[model samples]
Each structure stands twice: as C-alpha cells, then as structure tokens.
Target: MKSVKGHLRNRLVKARKKSAGQANIWLFYSFKLDADVPIIGDLEMLYWVSELETQPQVRRFTMEHEVEISLEELGDSFEEITVTRVEHIDGSIEFHQVASKQHDSFEKVSVPVRYKIENRIEKSHLVVIPAARLKAFSKSSLSFWLKVIAFVSQVRGYDLRYEMGQVGTSISICGDGTIETLLESLSITDPALAVGAVCRSVLQGNIIVDGLRSFGRNTRWRTP
Candidate 1:
C-alpha cells in the first residue's frame, strides 16, 4: 500500500508538471490616480523580469522570459489621465513606475504565486489563478464552477469557498478531501480547465451571495 501511494504521488507530480507546461498564466497591473495626470507626449515604458524555467533540451521551451510595454504616441496637452495600467493578457507581465523630486526610476516588482497539493487520497492541487482573468470569467461561466465546488465540497466533507476581493482572488477548501478527489470532482483534466476551476472556485459563492443580497435589499427598499 505504501509503495502504491508513492507511485500515485509520483504520477500526480508528473501530471501537475505536464498540466503546468500547457498552462496559460497571465498577470495584469493597473495604476489609477485619484485625479488625472499629465502626459509629456513621450511614450511610457514598462518591463519586468520573470522566473519561468526554460529547458534547452525541449524544443518548445525558451530560456528567457520578459515583458515590456511602450506607449509612444500621446497628446501634449492631454494631461490628467484617469488611470494608467498594464496588462499581461497572456504570459507574465511585471514593472514599476515611480516619480520623485530628486530622480525618477522604474523598479522591478515581484508577484508571488503559490501552488500546493491537498488530500493525499484525492490529489488536489491548490493553485492561485490570476485576478484579471477571474474578473473576466466572473462576467461569464462563473456559476457553473460554483455549483461544482459546492457539490464537491459537500461530497468530500469539505468547506469550499471562493473569496474575490478588490486586491485579488483566493480559494479556501478544508476537510478530509484530497487534491485528487477535488480535481476529479471538477472533471478538470486539461490546463485550461484546471486554471478555470481554480479561478471559478475562488470567485464563486461570495459574489453570487453579495449580488443576491443587494437585489433583496433593493427589492425591500422598493416595497411599499
């Protein structure tokens, strides 16, 4: 039984790596001022260093990962930009912009991501999906995963909740459910599905509950 468990563990790890290889992870950052800002007509530039591994032996793999943004054309009098943001729609995006009396510089900001396995029996990997995509998905097809998470949580004797906030997205699942069981329950075998499930599970119940409450409040307000 111990050996069998070990074999299963190895297989799970391999599967996770394979899935990750096919994963399309994205990062988006936005900077909004309380008021509009001035533009000098010069293009704004942004760049970031990423820690993605590149394997030379793999023809599909590249050794370097970097992101850059350039905004060259701008109106001189067009001061007061409401918001300034950069989105890494696909792949990774990172950068920093700063202003000061002495000097202005762009620094590298690190966005950390964590992935882990839960429940040895079920083999579920807890992954943190990007927030931009969460917002996009929440606009469509979010309820499906909510039901899946709720059902899976109930079946596996776990409390599964998706918490979406202004800052980012997160998922909480606690009980005797294993990672494998959680993944299986979601019926996710591909990278897209895996990431989608993570994002869905994270954004599910809270937004729905909040919307329902808001609706009820509005209805009550209108009630004579």
Candidate 2:
C-alpha cells in the first residue's frame, strides 16, 4: 500500500511539472482605489496600512524589494494601482507598485491643497508639486529638464532650475518679491487664495489675473 501511494505521488508530481511547464511562478494582484477620492502620494501609505489590518491570519511575508507605484494623474478619476510579486530561488520575494488603469469619475473634483511646508528655508517661493511627479524627476537627469524652459517661460519671470536633492522642480523667484509682497500687490487678503493662485501658476503655466497680476506673483521683482 505504501509503495502504491509513493508511486501515485510521484506520478502526480510529474504530471504537474509536465502540465504546468514551469516549476514555480511569481504572484501578482490587482489593487484599486475608490474613484470619488483624490489620488495623492500619501494615499499609498493608507493602502499599506489597510493591508496591515489583515495581519496574523494572512501570515506575514518578508518583501525582497521595495514597492514603487507610478503617479501619473489622469484628467478623470478612475485610477488603478497594481501590485506585482516576484518569487526568487532563495525563497525571497519582490514587490512592486504599478499604475495601470484609469477612468473618468464625476463624483469628485480634484483641488490643489494648501500645504504648509514645516521649517521651509527657501523664503523666495513656495514650491508645490505632486509627490509622484517629484519621484520621476529625481530619477531623471539634466536632459529631462531642458524642455521645461519653454513651459516655464509661460510663467513669465521665474527660471526653472533642477535641484538634485529636491523632490520637484522649483522656481526660485529670480525677482525679489516674497509671498507677502505678492499678496499685497494682488490685493489678495486670503493666504489660501494666494497659495492656490501660486500653485496654479506653477502647474498650469499661466495665471488668470490681468496685467502684472496676470503673470502671477513669480514675476514680481520687489524693491530692495
């Protein structure tokens, strides 16, 4: 009976190998985010936390490599996050994040956030850039930024310089005006509005106001 059982097991293993072709395969899964919510860099951390909630029962696994997901924001809201796992011969696994799908969503209107940079040293201009875009920029070299000159010219006075240590491209006001000067000249009382306006100018390549205000605050060279 034992000899028969061993023969059957051997046959089953051989069958599996022949039919499957490969001895083992990497595992992967699809992850999706709700369409109504905005896609933010920090949201990835939320997903990581949610996965942790399934601990113990799910069994903890050691990751062989760090995960990275693409951060290209679509005009519409349907965004898909893909997680990939690679199995290695040494019993190690690698995980990666991928942005694979997108669709339109009418439930939510994306808005620029007024984020305060704690201990911000550069007093010239407030830099606001999507974290994912910043990561892409970091991976690139100086050649990647050459085209930015024409796009930045649309903003008027600011020069787009690449900072190797920084997360995103920053326009350090070539002129003298600071945030306070900008608010005063534009007759803008609210700081949030000012931040939004500045953020829009940096992102959209142009500001809505007319004359000097039309070019936005970046062009304003203050009186020393």
Question: Whose lDDT is greatest here?
Answer: 2
Report the lDDT tens digits of candidate 1 across residue range 3-106: 52332223221111112243344332211111222222111111111111111111121112121221213222111111112223243322222121122222
Q: How many steric overlaps are in each model, in order? A: 13, 1
Instruction: State each model's CA lDDT, in order.
Output: 0.25, 0.28
Best by TM-score: 2
Q: Cα deviation in Å at residue 72, candidate 1? A: 28
Among all windows of ten consecutive residues in candidate 1, which has the lowest summed lDDT?
45-54
lDDT of 2 by residue, 1-224 (tens): 55522322232211111122332332222111111222223323222222221111222332222222212222322112222233333543333332212323212112221111244211111111223442333344222222222233233332322211111212233234543455454434444444444433433322222122223344443321
Q: After superposition, how far is residue 195 of candidate 2 from its true place, in Å?
A: 2.2
RMSD of 1: 23.9
lDDT of 1 at 126: 17
